[model samples]
Target: MRAALKWVLWDVKDTLLKVRFSVGEQYCREAERIGLNLKPVEVNSAFRQTYKSYSSRYPNYGIAQGLNGHSWWTGVVQDTFSLCGVQDPALLQTVSHNLYHNFCNAQNWEVFDDSKKVLEACSSLGLKQGVVSNFDKRLEAILKSCDLLSHFSFLMTSEAAGVAKPSSLIFEQALHNCEVSATQVAHVGDHYINDYLASRSIGIHGFLLDRDNKYNQSGIVPKEHCLNSLEELPSRLQEQMD
Candidate 1:
């Protein structure tokens, strides 16, 4: 018989809450406010390119090797502006600060329509819930502002754990925090590697939330482990328990 899942750990951004604005749009708006002229699309393209390049070099490389969240994101913002032909150091700092603060506001984000129902169902089942995300410390404040703080018993960030996902350390920390063994926990998130494979590596059941059906073509996850929506979660777990 399979062990019953007692804890449902979650990844916050892109899983429960979606940012209302794209990084490029937010950056461009902040830049315009600071007297810089740039189109949203242009800023978006540059931001994507810069972010992709950074990720390619260091996957989920946040708050490690003496780099804190502010410094890490400041570098990203600087690189983004540099790619967009805005190379002024002081201006980059100002734009990055504005962009960072904008993200902390709950108005800048929206919870997925299916998220609350799933959380409520899981809660009614008496399952413990918490957030295990690769975000920074600001995630706690953001979750609180988004009205999601009450649903979670704990929030673990990359900054707090000193390691990001795809590393077993963070998942191990989550297991420790929940006071459960690996087999007694299940994690759900949007990313294939960071969410699914990472949790699975440490024996935690992992489910990928592929709401758009985009991952069907990639074959990164077995169809059984892929969920198209959070609404399916409670029933899926119940079926497993049965």
Candidate 2:
């Protein structure tokens, strides 16, 4: 029989908390506040392109290349604005810095509607929780700002773990921190490969939060493990323990 679940590891981004505004909108807002003019649509598109390029070039904040989280994200921000026609070096620096620090504020993030209720339900069930996210160092402040910090016993970021999801090392580290066998834990995340498969590979139960039904027809995730909302989770855990 599967071991009783003692813990529920969480993925922060897109799982519990999401940015309150589009990157383009937030970036344009910050720039315009400082007297610069830019189109939200253009800035948003540029950011997506730049972010994808940066992720491909520097996976996990490019730690292997001696780049830390701040430097890596700053590069992405600067390049994104540059692509959107912000040519003045001083202006780029100013906006990039503002945008970077702005993300750490509570105004930039929102907790999912169901997150607190599910967390409370799990807590009532006597289970501990921790964060295992592919996020940078700003995660704690962001979580705190969203008032979600008290729910977790620990926070593990890619910056701290020196590894990111889809890599077993971070999950291994979470397992160690929990001091429990893999079978006694479960992970919930929105990403298919990163949160679900990665944890399952090491024996932790995996639950995919398919809020958009993106994977419903993918034929990849098992039907039992796919969840449409956080509300379904406490019951799932109860079923597992039975």
Candidate 3:
């Protein structure tokens, strides 16, 4: 005797979608041209580490009393480069941000093949769809730019929801907006802890999407059901409906 499914919330970023950046060694060549010994791997790693740390802390420092206003990703790029021994922090910061901006909204970011095909199938079958992300204000613009914003009925952002994931409030807000109860929803995200564990705590069914199967979140049942791609979701849901 299992529960029926009704609401479904999906994570953005690496779950249902992935974004591309810097074509044909653009930035690596540019960094060298600027007289900095930078490799694509170094820049990529630095940017990613910086983004993760700052995005995690953003809402905590954002707009609180006496908290100075700033962008987290900007700080991430700046601080990461500084740690790597860059002297001209401002110039490098500016260039890096421009590079990251170009990356974020570029025609490069896209929904995965598995996600798109499954979503189209699910939508055709009328699954309530919503999106939740631990992100800043640019979410709407990014989604719209990528032609993905309209597919969702609800979008919960860290900035907009006044909190990030692992906080049930944001998930609750998403539930309210989507008109779905926790018992009936499923959330999919790349991170095991935030996307899967948090949703599980909210009494919702959850999915941990591991494309490479590189990471696994503890305490989930039926690992086979924890998909490697969204392609399996439709058939999986059909199994449930059976």
**RMSD to native for every prediction?**
2.2, 1.2, 3.8
Residue-level lDDT of model 2, residues 1-242, one tens digit each, is 66788999999989998999999889999999878899989988999999999999999999988998999989999999899878889998998888889999989988899999999999999999999999899999998888889999999999999999999999999999999999999999999999999999999999999998878668688778999999999999998788
Q: Whole-model lDDT for model 2 versus the true structure?
A: 0.92
Instruction: Evaluate residue 176 in candidate 1 and report its C-alpha lDDT on the 0 to 100 scale.
Output: 90
- Candidate 2 C-alpha error for residue 156, in Å: 0.8
Candidate 1 lDDT by residue in tens digits, 128-210: 89999988778988988888889899999988888788899999988999997898898999998999999998899899999
User: Clashing residue pairs, candidate 3?
Assistant: none
Best by lDDT: 2
Candidate 1 lDDT score at position 154: 94
Against the true structure, whose TM-score is highest? 2
lDDT of 3 by residue, 1-242 (tens): 66567666888888766666543244555456557776667767766777577556655436443232235555665676665567696667665666566555736676677766776777776677888887666777778887777678878887777677888888988888866567767777777778888888988777878788665355354575488778777776766555
Ranking by lDDT: 2, 1, 3
What clash pairs does model 1 have? none
* Per-model tally of clashing residue pairs: 0, 0, 0
> What residue runs in model 2 are displaced by over 4 Å at the alpha carbon?
none
